[model samples]
Each structure stands twice: as structure tokens, then as C-alpha cells.
Target: MEAVLYAQERSKETRATLNSLRENGNIPAILYGKNVSNVPISVEKLDFKKQFNEIGKNGIFTIDVDGKRQQAIVRNYEVDPITREIIHIDFLAVNSLSVITADVRIVLVNDAEGVKDGGVLQQSMFDLSVTTNVNRFPDAIEVDVTHLQVGETITVGKIRQQYPFEINHENDEVIASILPPRQEEEISTGEEQEPGIPENLEGREE
Candidate 1:
């Protein structure tokens, strides 16, 4: 989880730098620490894109700011609405050994038996935030979908603990469910195409 990141010192304070950085494939960011004051910094967009994709938005990061290393985590990120281009980023300083809470992405594994039986799989929660030491945090939560049956609900409490962390979400919150799949394929083929039928449902490509 601890990886070295390099950044440049910037102080122009103009929002135009943000645009300029984007054009150069760099991220406009600020580094702030409880022990250190806020400092303007810029990082290569390509480097950040790779790290973010692998570690996610909340994982621990070791940033080298002006040759001084600091332990931090991503606090916020802004992306273009239409183009989905990253714009702004914020980093919060933290001790590498300190305990912190972060939301980890949930990955559904295997094809559910219920879905194979003409049932729809609903992922209610995409991520589960937890409290744990920085060194002990997990990259993601794995929820097995193989045993789920139609109309069966998987709650946060049902997850097998593979890591030593405290789950902060409600135990009763359904993370995934098996519902009856839509039987509209037969009807749609026979009828004219309707307006406003999206290509994907719930942001899934299917």
C-alpha cells in the first residue's frame, strides 16, 4: 500500500493552472497535514490514474513533496462531468501506522445461481466503509455470489471477515440481492422499440 509518488511545488494560485495541468496530463492538487501546512503540488496525471485505479480513492499514499515524504490519503477528486477527465484532487495527511476509516469497493464474484435461473442480481451497496489501521486496510471487499438464491439478500453482516477491520455500515443493509429478471426480451422483440430505454441498467454494462 505504500508507494512513492513525486510532485512539483506550485504557487501561482490561479485556477488557470488547473486547466494547464490537465492539458499536460498532470493533476492539480494540494497537500495538507495536521503537522504541516497546506502546500500546492502537482502530480503526473498518468501516474495518478494508474495508482487510483489500483488502490482506489481512499488508500494510503506516500507523496514526496519537495524531497520531504508525507503519508496521506486521497480526500477528494473532481472529474469532468461530460468527458470524465480528472480535474482537482485533495490529499489529507495521516500517520502510516494510525487507524483510519475508509470506504472500500465491493466486488461480487462468480455468477450467482439465482441469476442463471432467470433472476436479476441487484448490488445495493457498491462499497463498504470501515475503520482499521492504515497498514491493515484491504484493497477491496469480496462478496461471493455463488450461493445466493432468488429473493435472497446478502447483508453487510454476512460478509466473511478476511481482514481485521470494523465494518461501519448497517448490518441489515442489503449489499446484494437476487430478484426476478425482466422477461421483456420476448415482448420487446415483437413490439416496436420504445423511447428512453437505456442501454445499461444501474450503471452496469451487462
Candidate 2:
């Protein structure tokens, strides 16, 4: 799906002017890419929401500034803590041949064999940094958990072989693991980490 956004170039970068832009229902953003400095612009909130819902964050979209169109990807965005509204967004211009570095999700498919046997499933890693041509990178990576047994694990080094992109993670980093069922009298349990193979991950920033 193709999505396009039309934005007006912003010249007044003062705080007061930016606040006024937001008050008028526009989202202030910047355009950045290789050999390109940040270019400030603003977009109508309603138009942005409509197109964003169609193409999603990772998909490529066209940003038209005063009739000049540039292909770009959503690099990052910020939300207002008080009202939970989108405040600022950063866009990175991209080409189809570019090898983009982005976060792709990891999902477990099929009920684990261990989970069927009263074992717990621990998903420590939810997303991974992957490097691949923009056309090849997937929205997510699905891992088969049909055969995982108690005390078994799937690690970064092990799972990357099943995909096209290179997973930028340490070899021993655990992705998913099956743990033995918890025993009775396990205190300090409510609203906490899982009992066995507790989710342990020092997630990286994309």
C-alpha cells in the first residue's frame, strides 16, 4: 500500500511558534537522511493518522513539501505524556536498494510442546535489530515453538539461520525458552516475573 503526506515547510522554529502549530492541530516533524540536514515541517493530524494507519510505521511513504515529493520511512516518533497525542516525528529518507537497520518483532507460533505439559513459556526477546535491503526485511519473524520442550531454548545464533537478514545480537542471547512447571509454596509471586527461566533481557535501543 502506498501512502502520501503533504506538509508545509516551517520557517519559525521558536518554541512559541511550535506550540502554536500544535495548538492548530498539526504535528511538527523533521526530515533527515544521508547527506541531508534536518528540515522542519508540519502536517495535518487528521491526514497523518489516515495514511499512517494504511501503510504502518515501517512502510515507505511519500512526503510532499510544497509539491516536492521525497520517499521516506518513519524513523521515530514521540507522544505527549499528558494527552497521549503524537507530538513529534522523525522521518528518514530511504530508497528501495538501501539496507535499512530496523527493529522487527519476534513471535512464537503454535502452542509449545512444553506448555502443553504444564511448563511455562518465557519469551525474553520480543524484537530484534535486523539489517537487510528494505524490500527484504519482514514486518516480523515468526519462530516455530511446536517442538520446544522443558529446559530447552532458542537462541539468537540458532534462530537467525532460519531468516534472511542478519540478527545483530550476541550469539548466546536467549530468545524463547521452556521452563519446568512451578512447584507449590513459591512465595513472592503475584504480579511479578515468571517463575522459571524468568524473562531476562537488556533490550537494545533501535
Candidate 3:
């Protein structure tokens, strides 16, 4: 929940972030805050890489811009889709206690039992949208499926949490389920294979 600080960009002199930052071996970015004006700046790519690695996408870093530091969060980051190199970035000024809505990953636990018992474990939701104070966001929600038998389902209401936020999904919505495995052999036996392929091949002279 710690917040990062950023430097104010003073001049608009810099253009062509790719070429300038490459020739100078730096990354170009702009910093703006709700309370502060936009400023253009650049930082060493290596240094940015180090900080990003330490904190990951959820991390906050103090960006030094022309010596005047202000509160900021990574609003957006531009990366090369193919090479995934950092290209451009936009920083937004953030307050420490602001409420934010974000997507949190949903993880399923003890799911292999379903597959072992001729049941299929179907995960219908990957990420769940949640609203919470910025500092108290949950990393993920873990659902225990060890006791879930075939035809049983786990819904959003079944998840219990009293910390920092609330789940946005409906109570009746199925997060995951254990369904009876499809009986391919039984289903195939119900249908007769058409005689088209065999009928065509039998008359081929080649």
C-alpha cells in the first residue's frame, strides 16, 4: 500500500522517445497529477528496469523529475508487443487512501479431485472485479473445491471476506463447478456414422 513519488516535468523539449532515449540510453515518460501539471521527463532504462523488477506491476516507485517530487502511480505503460521493451509511460498522481476498483485473480484449490472422479472442473471466471481502498487490495481470492462433488457449484456469495473491499459478482453467479464428465463413448453410440467417406473411397480407382 506504499505510494511512490514522481518528479515534475518542466519542459516539452523532448521528442521521439524511442530515438532520444536509445541514443542517450534512457526511457521517456510524462508525469501528471490531479494536483500537479503535466511534465515531460526521462529516466535511465536500466534503473527503471531494476525498480520495475523489484516491485512488479503492483509496485509503486518514486520517480525523480527535475528534482521536484510528487505523488504518482503508473497510469499506463507502453511496451513493444513483440519485444516487450518499455516504450513510453504515463504516470498519474495518486493519494495514499483513495478507493480504487481493480481486477483480482481468482484461484481454484483442490481442483484435481474433480478430474480424478470422472468429473470436470470448470472455472467460469478468471478474474473478479473488486472495490476496495487502495492500500488493502487482496492479491487473489482462493476457492476451496476439495469437498465439491459432481453437479455441485461454488458461487460468489460462498466467498467470505471482511477486509478492505467487496466482490462485485452476483451471489448466484457460479464461480466454478464440478460437472459430470462428458461420456464420449455413450454419446457416440447414440449416433450412426454416415457412410459418405467409405462410400466415396470404395469407388476411387486411383
Candidate 4:
């Protein structure tokens, strides 16, 4: 889960300089953390994307700037709205003993018994916020719904028993549920009124 990314120090923060870096296939980024000074740098976009795909957001890796390497994690990033390309990135320097807060994607595993019986499956939460050591961070949390029946729900309290990390949510918070067929039909059948011209104006035009 750990890999090294090479970067160069960026001396200028001007718009023109950032644009030039992007044109040269580099992504403008900043590295900072507790007790560490913020350093402006740029990394090769292709290399970054390759490493990012291997190590998810919660994975810890090393960033080599100039000749010095630091252990870091992906803190944040900005993407181009039009091109859907990453434009900027924020890296946080961390150590093995550091406890960081990260969002882990929630994955539903197995087919719910309710779904096999024609019940509609609804997921309320897509991810979970948790605080854990850098080495203990999980890429995603999987919840098994194989036995879930209609009218039943999976809650945060139920998931806590399976993982050791601290989840930053209330125990009673619902994650996923199954609705009965009747309720699903009612929700789908509630149609909105369509807009139409008035009868008096139907025969007239400007």
C-alpha cells in the first residue's frame, strides 16, 4: 500500500506558473502537516494517477521532493469541472504513530434476503468517517446484508461490533434498509402533474 512519488519544488505561486505546470503534465500540489512547514511542489500527473489508483485515499505513501522523502497521505484535491482531471492536490505528512481522520467508502456485500423476495433495497449512508492509526486505516468498510429482511435495517451500532476503529457517527444511525413491496409501489406510483396549455388558450396563438 506504500509507494514513492517524485515531485519538484515550485518556487512561484502565480497563475501563469500553475498554468505552465499543468501544460507540462504536472499537477500543482502542497505538502503540509503538524510541525511541518507548507511546501509548494508539483508532481507528474501520470505518475500521481498511477500511484493514486494503487493506494486509495486512506493509504499512506512517501512523497520525494528534491532529494528528501516524507511519509504522506492524500488530504484533498481539486478536479477540473469540465475535463474531470485533477488540478490540485494536498498532501499531509504523517508518521506511523499518527492518528488521522479519514472517510472510508461503505460497501454492501451479499444479496439481502429481502431483495430476493421482491423488496426494494435502499442505502442511506454511502461512507463512514473514522479515526484510526495510519497503518490501521481501511480502504473501505464492508457490511454484510445477506440476512437482512424486509422492514429490517442495518445501523451503525451493529457495524461497530465488527471493526476496531472508532466511527464518528451515532450508534443508532441507519445505514441500509429494505422496504416492503407495497411501500415501494406507493413511492413509485406517486406521479407529478404534467404541465399543459389551458383549454381556453389551446385554440389561440401569438
Which runs of model 4 end up more than 4 angstroms from their true locations?
Answer: 182-206
- For model 1, residues 113-169, the per-residue Cα lDDT tens digits are 999999999999998888988777777888899989998999987873655789997
lDDT of 4 by residue, 1-206 (tens): 45899999999999999999999999999999998899999999999998898988788779999999999999999999999999999999999889999899999999999999989889999999999999999889999999999999999999897998999999999999999886433457567766898667897969
Candidate 1: where are CA atoms >4 Å away? Answer: 16-18, 160-163, 180-206
Candidates arranged by lDDT, highest first: 4, 2, 1, 3
Estimated TM-score per prediction?
Answer: 0.76, 0.84, 0.71, 0.87
Pairs with steric clashes in candidate 2? none
- Candidates arranged by TM-score, highest first: 4, 2, 1, 3
After TM-score superposition, the amount by which residue 153's alpha carbon in candidate 4 deviates from its true location, in angstroms, is 0.3
Question: What would the C-alpha RMSD of candidate 2 be, to one decimal place?
Answer: 14.6
Q: CA shift at 158, candidate 1, in angstroms?
A: 1.8
Q: lDDT per model, in order?
A: 0.84, 0.87, 0.70, 0.93
Q: How does residue 200 of candidate 3 score in lDDT?
A: 54
lDDT over C-alpha atoms for residue 72 of model 2: 87
lDDT of 2 by residue, 67-172 (tens): 9888888899999999999988898988777788899888889999999999999999999999898767687789899999999998998887888888899989
Report residue 143 deviation for candidate 2 (angstroms). Answer: 1.3
